[model samples]
Target chain A: MNARGRIPGIRNQHQVLFYALSTCIWCKRTREFLEANNIAFDFVYVDLLSGTEREAVVEQVRRWNPSVSFPTLVIDGCRAIIGYRPEEIQEALGL
Target chain B: MSEIPREKVEALYQRLYEEAEASGYHLNPDKEFTLGLVESLLINEARYGYWACPCRLATGEKQKDLDIICPCDYRDADLLEWGACYCGLYVSEEVLRGERPLQSIPERRPPEGQRPQEQPARAPAVSVTELPLPVWRCRVCGYLCAREQPPAVCPICKAKRDRFERFL
Candidate 1:
């Protein structure tokens, strides 16, 4: 709940922002899981961004979760989940 | 990324296998997946002069990416705790024997802002001083220290003791 800025993909009071790394296996799995479940979400490949942009995004992620690990999921702009925990993501999404 | 020939990748896999064996380590039990990771590593090495971990992003600056080289600093601890490294390329004995399941490992590398500043290069010197303690080198960050034993964990790179190599 320490996150800043408005969450993306908001619909029906539900919003999801996925932060990932392009080559990360867990990130890919999380993406596939969200898509398969028909969940609307926005994602940014932290590794694919330009140096400055990547730093800024990483800083934002750190603010939300100090770990700043990949596949970080932000739901409703307040609830943040670190790593690809399917059960947690599912619960957070109310799926 | 340029395509690496299958034969070349296989050759690199063979070498990596032998090296792992020699180092008293084991590759992941999944052969196909391990081979795929090896191929990716080869591709990264081709793109970047050094063999960087395929799972992690590399800055293409050797000094900046020292901790992400093939045998990354966290490999030992990851294998010890999670039965596999983050990428699952290296595994613990239990995982290798199928006695344990590979699990996701937390990132041990500190964030960029928290990472220790790179040490400046040493100036040329001719004097040699003998020490009673053994010298150990951290393969990931290239940190070298002479002590009775290597640190339980690398101070700079956070690599475990197994990651250290005898310098002398």
Candidate 2:
């Protein structure tokens, strides 16, 4: 829905809203990969946040894939790639 | 009583003691380590023998040795199905009299706010103000577990499901 008579790209510009635990090795690795690639992304620390905040996150994850897992990678507005594998992520995002 | 030297057990006990101390736990290193060795030996014994004793000891309602409970029980129950008690004289009496094999340590705490199981999300309707407040959508699949009601176990993949980047 746009003046251009075409669907607009998602307004959300960030590559990911990475959810992770501080002690979890994989979550840390995912964050490192995003930083190294210079991809600006949102990060949610599930351990530190309150119950309500956590609930919000769960709702979001469910929307993307019924089978969503952690270290979810959100692309554009509607696509999600779960877990962290740089090459797999790149391929999925066509980066 | 077997061929395993007492020195080996002592060394292991010493290392375990150091770890406990470093972790800020006040424990009698020799005693705790010996108990640990005994527990391991008992596990081996269970595999080979037909005898199995209760995993924990309790007096009336109080319990002890929360650590040895299976992780499954920790995550599945509402009340901690296990924890340690500190009734000093009673504990000493029991131990000295050989009535209690495992001594009570302090209760092992879970990470803050971590319940055994994720509470079932309530279907309470969000207010209009809350409406369109923000819903995090996953990028992997179009799963929506819900916000303002964080799903403990993601209904989809059972991830510690949480918010995603919001669209609006």
Cα TM-score per model = 0.71, 0.33
- Specify the highest-DockQ model's number: 1
Clashing pairs in 1: none
Give me candidate 1's TM-score against the actual structure.
0.71
Interface RMSD of 2: 19.6
lDDT (C-alpha) at residue B102 in model 2: 32
How much is the lDDT of residue A93 in candidate 1? 79
Writing each residue's lDDT as its tens digit, candidate 1 over B67-120 gives 677778777777777888877888889998889976656778776755422534
lDDT of 2 by residue, B1-168 (tens): 234356665664465446434532222223643444434333423332311112221111111212212211222121122111221111222333455443323223343234222234334344445464445443222346446644554343222333222322
Alpha-carbon runs more than 4 Å astray in model 1: A1-13, B1-11, B113-129, B132-134, B140-168
Poorly placed runs, candidate 2 (over 4 Å): A1-14, B1-168
